[model samples]
Target: MSDPVRLGDVLAGMATPGGGGIPAQPGAGGTTCNRCGARADWHRTIRDKWILIELGEWPVGAVPPGKRWRVAGEGTAVNLGRAQPSDTCRICHFDVCPSQPAPVGSPALLAQWQKNAWG
Candidate 1:
């Protein structure tokens, strides 16, 4: 049997850089939020992208239909929760984080992602 899904798994499956689930494109890896057709971006902190999922800012289940909200500009890290971005493939949502950058990839760029990411 496979291991159960952890918060990391959920985030990674979304294909964001950290555990945060932000797709560079909606439906990039067949990723679909029950509420939103597809995630626009991962961090509202970077740009207003995701909807709150609901009032009171609850987790997965508590989100009310239509009321989903997204974060933008610096919000408290605590509010963001411990979640990171998806390591899964940006296409299938079924891969782990890449440890090494591709050939010709800039190490400086990856370093910036590491600084901003949780892991």
Candidate 2:
């Protein structure tokens, strides 16, 4: 019998590094966010849109499990699936964007901004 595909599995399968997804362009990998001017590493998402991945990786527990991300082999930003013990994941710049207010009622996100965010 075959195992049923779950939503997470489906989502993960949709993004394979160096697969059909758009390649990261030269000089676009590093830049500053115009809204708040924070340093970030940009990568093209599978959906064909740009995403601002923070320049560093943090402990898996530092951010919510679902919010964690990792750079794929081809420079694509992808979710940090099924975090194991002591795993580290890169973060999205939007979570710490000083120009935008932190999400209400989520202490983890708020704490992340207050502790290590940059303008």
Candidate 3:
């Protein structure tokens, strides 16, 4: 029988299907909430915004017809060019946080993921 797939392999496969284009690997930045010191896992970056534009998912130079991209502070406009790097805490869901660049996957974490996926 075929061996089980490793978690890293599965994640890498999902990140870059068919090895066709640049993989959207998560940023190598371990972000934490400035207010509460909680670790952050969510991020909004320029590359993500551009993908939406390139796929025509977000209309350029106009307000999107629906309430899709409407956040409390951001208006209902689809401005891909204005995208910035923002991180959110996984535990608290806080938006205001400062992040430091760190390696994307630690050796231990990667090993654990691989074991879990294989098993």
Candidate 4:
């Protein structure tokens, strides 16, 4: 059999900000596609522990708080939970856990970053 695919790499490839991967929606500005690093809307899915992800960003108050994209395939569809803004990005979530609390205008941004996190 082939090797286990890298979820992060796969997400980056399929991520297309506007062309299906991710589009510039409200509330999602500054956030780029983790895969392609493009500012587009993306979709996400977690199948058998392998997550398929995407993302995008846009101006303020244009999109909803955390209603970004959708997850495909079947299993137990879990929605994006509450917004938690920490000092470090998701790469540090499990490793660092943020010693200090997030500053202002961070919770939203943090959530956005996490939405696009692969590591």
Q: Give the alpha carbon lDDT tens digit for every residue of 5-114 in model 4.
A: 89986787555334343443323423444443534322233321222232322333322334322332432222333333322111212111222243234455455454
Candidates sorted by lDDT, best first: 2, 4, 1, 3
The root-mean-square deviation over C-alpha atoms between each candidate and the true structure, in angstroms, is 18.6, 8.8, 17.5, 15.6
How much lDDT does each candidate structure score?
A: 0.30, 0.70, 0.30, 0.34
What does the lDDT read for residue 76 in candidate 2?
69
For 1-119, candidate 2 gives per-residue lDDT tens digits of 59888998766755543444544443366787777777788787666566788787787776776677887788867866567444678878888777778855457567666654543
Model 2, which residues run further than 4 Å from truth? 1-27, 81-86, 104-112, 115-119
**lDDT tens string, model 1, 1-119?**
69887998776655454335443443222233333233222322333243222112233233222222333334311232323232111110011113323212334333333432333
**What is the TM-score (0 to 1) of candidate 1?**
0.17
Comparing 3 with 4 on TM-score, the higher-scoring candidate is 3
* Candidate order (TM-score): 2, 3, 4, 1
Clashes of 3: 0
CA lDDT, candidate 2, residue 50? 62
The best candidate in terms of lDDT: 2
Clashes of 1: 18
Tens digits of per-residue lDDT for model 3, 1-119: 69898999876865552244533323423444333454433333223321111111222222212212322132112323334223210111221112222212334323322332343
Model 2 TM-score is 0.64
TM-score leader: 2
Higher-ranked by TM-score: 2 or 4: 2
* Poorest lDDT segment (10 consecutive residues) of candidate 2: 17-26
User: Could you tell me how far off, in angstroms, the CA of residue 8 lies in candidate 2 after the best superposition?
Assistant: 30
**What would the TM-score be for candidate 3 when compared with the true structure?**
0.21
